[model samples]
Target: MADMSVAAPRSRGLSLPRVNIRAVVMVLYLGFLLLPIYWLINMSLKTNSEILGTFSLWPQNLTFDNYRTILTDPAWYMGYVNSLIYVVMNTVISLTVALPAAYAFSRYRFMGDKHLFFWLLTNRMAPPAVFALPFFQLYSSIGLFDTHIAVALAHCLFNVPLAVWILEGFMRGVPKEIDETAYIDGYSFGRFFVKIFMPLIASGIGVAAFFNFMFSWVELLLSRTLTSVNAKPIAATMTRTVSASGLDWGVLAAAGVLTIVPGALVIWFVRNYIAKGFALGRV
Candidate 1:
């Protein structure tokens, strides 16, 4: 009894707290991924001189002038508005066009169906550069140049195919019996699709919209090529930071930080849907 009590006290004193290896690794991995974003924000708040001269994790002389310039300047802020306009338009158009096309693809059987599906995918596979010149020329000739709709339409060339492909996958997973049953219960195709079918694949729609939004928002080549002034996107505006003096590093950093905000907010809003969409959709 005396020996047992002594050993228990000794063992208790020597014991160590449990360490979760996976949790530690995850934290370290996340920190590594976020380090650049943190540094960008850090640089945005510092002057160009400080950014170039110092190698600090945090800004020494913090200033909001960089952000203030972007927020206050019409040239800078309008870029954001223009980008939102086209990106939203593109997403809406892509989903609208893709829904019926995808449903047709998922539910029908016709000649060249496989070939047609492959053709749609080929458009997505083609490089954005391949169509850039053509789009530029076409839009310029049609008086659509430098317009938000021009960019939105150009983006649809890519986004619509991808949206169709993704939505088709989700639609395929859904049983045809549901469609039959809906028709049996005196429902029109439009009513059944709008009320019943669409809800079933809501996750897929969210995922498609998220991807379309991101692509349209970040597409520099087409947006820059097609637009000049009135409909210039923020991606195009960021290039103005380069001049005879050199790159405006602070303003550029601030712009980069601001650019990340919309995408991040979108991811936050549709995060759960994206997760489920991937799990259920063909992706």
Candidate 2:
């Protein structure tokens, strides 16, 4: 006891070196990630003239015309709205279907269950190109092509499997005793799931939703192929900026910058859930 105070300072001093090294590593990694984002912002601010004329690190003039064009133009802004519609619809559909399927996988074990689970995940591993022609023909025959619902449903082919996998992991982390106790208390399965199981796995749902939104948001291949001009996505519109004449670098950069907003909004809303969802030791 007499020497405890004296030893405390020495122990703390030893930790300082490790802390400093961690801090340095974090700073370097953050800089590496932020550098490219900084470059995009810098390019977005610069005019077409400045972009082609000079290799300047910073623009001599900053203009809002790019952002302005995106906001003012119906074709541009509507692309964002169209993207949001499909992304939200896809996320909702995927999560709803995944929650029940994942519950089945986690709470019950049956014949060939593991094989079925792997098969679900295997859908995710399939190349989008392989499904492109079949998807187009399928959507066309059903008269669902060129509609937002078509793309939303198409995205579910991949997103549902992913959502199921993520939520199943989270559900597996919950103790079986909780379900047993709830059953013993005379709670119906529906009541128990809605009240107890759902709250426990809420974080996982948010995390899964974020992933669905991100994947569907940035995906070009399926979104572009499934829809014609009326339902075309922002990614499809970006192609129009380039032609035989030349690329409209300003509008294109502006469009690229604008595309990041929906993803950012999604992360901002679900960031808290993401951290908690990844935590260990629940089971």
- Cα TM-score per model: 0.89, 0.88
lDDT of each: 0.89, 0.84
Could you give candidate 1's per-residue lDDT for residues 1-283 as a string of tens digits?
1133246444534434524666788999999999999988999999999989988889999999999999999989999999999999999999999999999999998899999999998988889899899999999999999999999999998889889988998898789999999999999999999999999988788888898998898889989999999999998888865563398889998999999999999999887667555553654
In the range 157-253, model 2's lDDT, one tens digit per residue, is 8899889988987888788999999999999999998998999988788888888888899888998899987788888878864563287677787
TM-score of 2: 0.88
Error of 1 at 124 (Å): 0.7
> Which residue pairs in model 1 clash with each other?
none
State which candidate has the highest lDDT.
1
Query: Which regions in candidate 1 have their CA more than 4 angstroms from the true location?
Result: 1-21, 276-280
Where model 2 places Cα greater than 4 Å from the true spot, the runs are 1-15, 272-283
In candidate 1, position 66 carries an lDDT of 96
Model 2: clashing residue pairs? none
